[model samples]
Target: MVKVVQPAYGRVFQDDEGAAELAKVLWKETVAALKEAEAVTLANLARADRYVRAKVEFENLYPTAYQQGPVLKGEEGGEYFNYRWSACEKLNERMLKLEKAMFGEATVKAGREKPAAGKVAADEFLGPDNGIRQ
Candidate 1:
């Protein structure tokens, strides 16, 4: 189940509008949460990319025993960094696919006319897979 975070402005809201107002509040909260998650995921991908590039450079320049195989136990630099690099790469791939689904070019029928690059129509997401109005 998805969870929505408390809105930063929630304290200013009143309870007079009852259920309808509450529903709107919840929807707003959900949108904010989604935006926050997107930002964090993007930032994480950037950090992971930097770490992987640096790891490759370090290995090339030093060519230490830990860099090759059977990294030394309790080592904090090479082995640990490599593990982090692998985990982050996996996460980055998943997030990028999701990002593509959200903001990048969505798949259309091969024979259909394609929209201008970066031009997503309003009704594009109004399908069974996505709840956005297509």
Candidate 2:
């Protein structure tokens, strides 16, 4: 006879034996996966940040503006430009891949009414008050 009101979603789930069982199994696995994904995402972020900082230092020293290939005048002086461009490209690719994986899984999981335990519950979330629509 107990109903756990999901405050944010305005839905409710009965705190019954069946619900408890489902939560025990499904939620555990989902949370574990999310944790692993988060770790990977964090590592990627750190690596990207380090690379960007290094690139900035290289830019200051080399000063791509001084290269005459495109603006100043000759392709030989633009080697630093190529290096910086490629490094930035690689960092961006890594960031995009990590972000996509993290966000895609989260979006799919959000649509389900009964997500596993440790996952964000309706009552636990707060947003613009448009419910999940926002």
Candidate 1 is scored at a TM of: 0.23
Per-prediction CA RMSD (Å): 20.8, 24.2
Once superposed on the true structure, which residue ranges of model 2 sit more than 4 Å away at CA? 1-81, 105-134
Worst 10 residues of 2 by lDDT: 3-12
> What is the TM-score (0 to 1) of candidate 2?
0.24
- TM-score per prediction, in order, is 0.23, 0.24
Clashing pairs in 1: 123-134, 126-134
Distance (Å) between predicted and true CA of 6, model 1?
8.2
Candidate 1 C-alpha error for residue 94, in Å: 0.9
lDDT of each: 0.44, 0.42
Q: Which digits, one per residue and each the tens of the lDDT, describe model 1 over residues 7-106? A: 3323333433343345344445435544665633444344333333333333333434335433334544443344544544554565455445434555
Clash pairs, model 2 backbone: 68-72, 68-73, 68-74, 69-74
